[model samples]
Target: MLFAIVSITMLSCGTSRNLDIERGTGYNFQAGHPEYRTTVFGYMDEEEGTLLEIGAKIVKGSLIYKDEDDTLQARISVEYQVQDLDNNNNVIISEQSTEIIKSTDQDISSTRETLDLNYTHPIDPGRYEVVVNVTDLNTNKNITQSIETAIPETQKGEYSLSNVLLDGKIVGEGGWEPISTYDVKSKVDSLRFVFQVISPQTDKRMEINTRLLRYASDTSYTRPMHYSNYSPSSIEYKGLDYDEETELQSNRRVLTDYASTFIEFKFANQERGNYRFEVRAQRDGDEEELFKARDFGVKSKNYPAVRSARELARPLVYLMGEDDHEELMKISNNDSLKKEVDRFWLKNVGNANEARHVIEMYYERVEEANKQFSNFKEGWKTDLGMIYVLFGRPWYTRSHLKELVWFYSYNHSDPEYSYYFNQPKLKNKFFPFYHYLLRRNNYYYTVQYMQRQLWLTGQILTRQI
Candidate 1:
């Protein structure tokens, strides 16, 4: 059972439009369109309502460097707006700032070096939407994304927990830095979570319990096409198989109203999967408990690269016939599976060199899909991930009120090359709000088949602006 039935609604296609990078509304935020990564954290502040922190990490290679007085430099602009969700999405706070990155080495942009930018703000307790916009000043290209956060109202005597923060110490790093992407890199052996426990009574003994659970399955498709005819239903929230648990007792002495503590969980040799980390706190004499949870993914050491035979075979649902894909997936032996996958590609392209090229290009799209569209399940398993892996990046992307549209051709008036996805009204705690459902139609069947034929014949399809 590699494929599961997905029910999705068929909506009328929308008008084709190009992304407006300057305005920041039409870009695909979840698809890594901004060429940067961002992470947000919220903390409880006694005086200020909530301390909101945004961390943006930009890879030097993604920036356009200009030579200035024998030195290479790049400039970036970051702007953010906080909107009150309860008040008709009114913008309550907005600010913009810029940073200049300089390098003496000319080849700096070719390396994996990165610049870290941090922003902090205080806001009242409420449900709010935070939109962060980042632009490469030299290129004038930008990306904008929005995330929903809730700040709990604090009471004097009630016990509460602040938002959990995930951090990791890289192999060479001296101190722990925030793992803002929530995807733990292969270089990290253990995960560190930091948060504050607020209690009313001084010198109170408390018990803290932590549990880690791993998802039971990965997002693999059994079907050929990504769209469905029925109304979309949420992905079933599979039970998280219990993996590990730990308990710590707080020493009965408190210097202030709240105590900050961090717990480390080792993930060395752990299977690759999505995991949930939960914490529960209760005072020794009281039954009331404070709890918090966060979800994250563990990437293979050679991340974004499909190394295993099973990983290589799964994405073939897009390229192989249903019967062929099913047979490939049925191979139980890893060695045999690897050989068969090699033979399939070699057979399709008719030569060893072309086979190698096609395999690399195909999986590269699969890897990019994983990085861009992953949610509760892997990105390639999602609707957007499927389209991305098959068709490559859309020539134009636009985000409407609750819908996301992508166009493959430069002709904005033609609906034939446009695809539409709508965000469902249903909500899931384990899923991000940005998840969208593809609008299926009979017309897509013809297009999907044509794309599959193009790939099988060793032809790469891409949109030229």
Candidate 2:
């Protein structure tokens, strides 16, 4: 089912985009980059002309940018879209955010131009559309073009994984931001978490921590050829009384009471390439053991650098307090609550009228919390829920602290932050004990103002909260 080639075509042309573009009914332009003399397609561009089992590939390669910004007096903007015309109802997936940019040498900021043009689509041999509409300073109107092509199917009973590269990262720091998985099969216990030291809250030169947890899982397992592999011995199965409605759990027993063996690894203090994570799996019996690896990188170069521990602890917002869950229920009923919620989503969309990231983030968070929260409670309605929804799940959490003290740490690489919290363990401890702290440099924000009351932000002492 995975053997599908994606056809591409220019979608629109307008004053919104500036450029000179051409896309014929069928791809006729010379393929590949002349300067590099590389092959037209990254892979062998095989477009089988079959409808039921046909795949087509297109390699537009790099955008040929002849910067005339100096004197040509030509300002251009371009927007593109490609569609599959074969099966009207079949879902056609195409890359939409690819772009090319040109700027003066001195304008070499992080906002400089980027070119991402490799596209793939599944379709039949027919008149597909490749639309690229461009606008220029000379005229206000934009031009649209289309291309048609046919694809020959691959040989019977065959497929390819030569160019397949599976890459992603942890939840915090927002790697693969809009991506989430409820399929237990897709879940990997230990992933190589990667991100830059851009957050003022993270230690730029800090070391990474690694932990291998003990679990009750079945020994037999199944995983993807490239994504992850199964270790029959390492997997402990959970009881059926628990609910795990994931697609991958169909034929296997579930796992519960999972915990990790705490371990930390140190990396050099130099900045260079993106971080790489590799997980080694041991096989039971005579199965061949193998290694799995993934890549993780951050998109926001100007990401807020992690704050110093002193800077993070400078101000204590609440000296002593209690988490009033009752306050949360009451505030949830606020008349203007919907307005605040709407604004939250609007900010993420960056476009209120056409915003979807808010909805996207909601589902993504819900799925992640459910999959992760079942360890002790339902994720959707716990303190973890309250926190994860706002900040995010910590990269590392430990139960070694007292029954009342639950430690949630993010980016263990940084040795500075000791982000642990003391919660309601003994229900009758005190009336107004410290719950949590949200610390800033000599300034603090109170979650108390939030509709739902959760915990105190930063409390390092028993004398306080």
Candidate 3:
């Protein structure tokens, strides 16, 4: 019998401190395909509290376009809400808007064309929960996401820095256009960072320092353990180390006090890797300093699609034995690595056609994992990524106060098909904000091994029967 993959409902619990974030689901072979993408940015405005910016990008292919008056049209509805975290999650601000996109050419609907949206709101400085809801009017499909953010207070005569904004445009092209995905595509030659510096004194020199750090390696999942709920007392964060440090601007004098000044920095020729961009501000004769950082990744030209031999070999760790994975990693030559990969699949599956099918399905999951769970490190290397690539998407997902649970079977009472991942609260700067550690236990060993054997023996040919 072939393995059957089914649709599952993801349950999220709402709370002030621990806001539940949800991703859209689909009936396709891949899992958690959010219909649209939304990005939120908060910047401090000297006169008008905080400037909240929201950008939502929707692919035309994902929506249902209708024929109206011989023109293809797609309608989208977006709602924004801001809740005060300090006030029992009370809704303080809300807005709703609808957009209708009309296209005369029907071919645009089949292509990967996108509808870009931009919204800006001024809010007070405080801790709040921001929620964005997007709906495709044609299909009535909706996706919602909530995030908890804190806006720092900047008073008069106080030196402070606004939130850093990232844009893909090179210098002197046009105005500031924020890159919503944060994932810098290979086509972008240079990255532009913009921020405002609120100065207290006029004609005073302020030093701005910028540092870039690349993700090194993660050894957290080197050994698989039995499933359990025992939380670690102290979790040592791994991956993301200091790669390069540089001062972008030094001793720059501001001409005005009690006003906001824009500071711009541009960097070119970034390598393909996960990175953390940090900025620090300090004024002469001031003992206090301000700092901010953001996480972004420089993806390969054909990202989410694993084409390189090295990239293809890395995800094989989930299926290969420890010694075998180590041996494959030792092969530095690209040509030899590709040959070994082809040999490994054929040796286990016993045929080229079946092996090809298995390889295609396996890498497809890897690509989807990268799209869903990537932050600082590639998604396939993350704990959740590893489980996704191994067992496929869970049958059901439920979120708790601080933990996320995934069930492989419809029967929630069965512990045998359940997996638990804990989100530990860490004070370290190196760790990403949304990192989750898998609660490894011996229970997973047998099931995961059985699944891996199914792939190797060519027992599982497709995602579903």
Query: What's each prediction's TM-score?
Result: 0.62, 0.19, 0.64
Cα lDDT tens digits for candidate 3, 1-465:
111010001122223211211111211212322255666556654366557666667766566678999999888888988898889989988989998888888776544456887787776666767777877788777777665565556555666665556667644656555665546656566777666676644456777776655555333343454545433432324344434333333333343344466766777737766565666777778887666555566765445557788778878888888898999989999999999999999999998999999998889888778777765556776778877887887888998876889888878887667777776654232343456777776777787888889888888785321
Residue 399, model 1: lDDT of: 88
- What residue runs in model 1 are displaced by over 4 Å at the alpha carbon? 1-33, 40-53, 66-73, 80-96, 102-113, 119-131, 146-158, 169-175, 200-204, 226-269, 284-287, 299-317, 320-364, 393-425, 428-450, 461-465
lDDT score, candidate 1 = 0.62
Residue lDDT tens for model 2, 149-182? 3333334322111111222334354543111111
Taking the candidates one at a time, how many backbone clashes does each contain? 4, 63, 6
TM-score of predicted structure 3: 0.64
Ranking by lDDT: 3, 1, 2
What is the RMSD of candidate 2?
23.8
Question: Which candidate number has the best TM-score?
Answer: 3
- Per-residue lDDT for 1-465 in model 1, tens only? 011000010111111111000001111433323456655556654455457666667767667889999889888899988788889999988989998989898777655556777777776666667787888888778887676666556566565655456667766767776665645556576566555565554456667776666655343452334445433332322212223323222222223334444334444434566666666677767876666555666665544447788889888888877888888999999999999989888887786876787788788788777667765456676778888888889988998776889899888666656878776643332233346567776777778888877677777633221
Q: What are the C-alpha RMSDs, in order, of all predicted structures?
A: 10.5, 23.8, 9.8
- Inter-residue clash pairs, candidate 3: 225-441, 226-440, 226-441, 226-442, 227-441, 227-442
Model 2 lDDT-worst window of ten:
33-42
Model 2 backbone overlap count: 63
